[model samples]
Target: MDLAARSPAYEGLAIELAVEDEGWHDAGLGDLEAFARRFVEAAARRAGVPDDVETELSVTLTGDAAVQALNAEWRNKDRPTNVLSFPIRQLQPGERPGPLLGDLVLARETVEREAAAEDKRFADHAGHLLVHGMLHLLGHDHIDDETADAMEALEIEALADLGIADPYADAPEHL
Candidate 1:
C-alpha cells in the first residue's frame, strides 16, 4: 500500500519521518510514513482537530539504546519502553503559524518482541503503538480507568481503520 494515498484525513499535516536504525532496512520508507500518518490523523480526529488544519509532527524509529536514553531523560525511566511521546506545548495558538504536535519515538527491539508475543505482524503492532503515541501527543492519556477505556477504544477504532486487528483482543499473560 502506498502511504501517501492511504489516509485522506491527514492530507494537510506535515509529517517528518526519520529512520534512525541501521537494522530497519527491511521496512519500507513509504510504509513507515503511511503508518505514522495514519496514527497522527486518527489521533487528531479523536481530539476534534480539523483534518485540514496544518500541523507539524515528527516520528523516529530507532534501536533500544536510543529510545532507552530518551525514556530515561524525559520520563526518568532507566530502560526503554515500547514508545515515547513528547508533545510541544510551548507553541502559542496564534503565535505559531501551525501546531507543532510533538515527537514520537519507537523502540525497534521492544516492538518486535511485543509483536511476536502478541502473535501479530510487526507492522500492525507498530501501527498500533504509533497511534497510541500520537494520542498521547495530542493530550490523550490513560491516567485513570475511565480515560484508559476511552483511549483504548479510540485506538481500537483507529487501528481497525487501517485494517489491523484489535491489538488488545488477545490480552497477553502479563496484562
Candidate 2:
C-alpha cells in the first residue's frame, strides 16, 4: 500500500525520514515535518505543482562516514558532501508526480561545517540544500550553462519563498 494513502498529514507532500545523526537532534533539525514542509513547499512552488497535488519524497540525515560511503558509491567521490540527491523518476510539465519524488541524503557534520565557514545560519544553509535536492528530484539539473542558469534561478526564487537568501549570491561571479 502507498504510505501516503495511510497518512493524514500528506496534504500533497509526504517526506519519509531516515535519521542516523545525533547532531540533528541537538540542532533541532530532527523535526521531519518542519523540514519536509519547507523543502516540499519550495519544490512545489518552483515546479508549478499546485498546493493540493500530492507528492512525496524521503530524506536521510547521517554522519560524514555514512555520506562518504554513499558519495563514493554513487558519484565515485571519496569525500563527504553536504547533500546528495537521488531522483527516482522524471515528470513532464503538467504531469502528476508519483508518491515518491526521490531521496535526499545529508551529511550532518559537513553541512554544519560549511554553514560555519560561510558565516550562514545552519538552518538557512540546510534549507538551501533541501531546496536544491528537491529541485533535482523535479528533473532540474545544472549539467550545462543554460540549465544551470535556469536551475539556479528557480532555486533562488523558491528559497525566497522560505525567506532564505539566494544561496549562490555569495558565490564568486555566479548569478
Judging by TM-score against the true structure, name the best candidate.
2
* Residue range 41-153, candidate 2, lDDT tens digits: 77667877766667678888889999999999999999999889897787653456687788898898999998898888888888888877877787777878888898888
| Model 1 spans > 4 angstroms off | 1-8, 28-30, 90-98, 172-175
TM-score of each: 0.84, 0.85
> Stretches of candidate 2 above 4 Å error?
1-10, 92-95, 173-175
Model 2, residue pairs in steric clash = none
Q: What lDDT would candidate 2 get against the real structure? A: 0.79
Compute the lDDT of residue 52 as modeled in candidate 1.
67
Which pairs clash in the backbone of model 1? Answer: none
Local lDDT at 82 for model 2: 88
In order of listing, the candidates' clash counts read 0, 0
How much lDDT does each candidate structure score? 0.76, 0.79
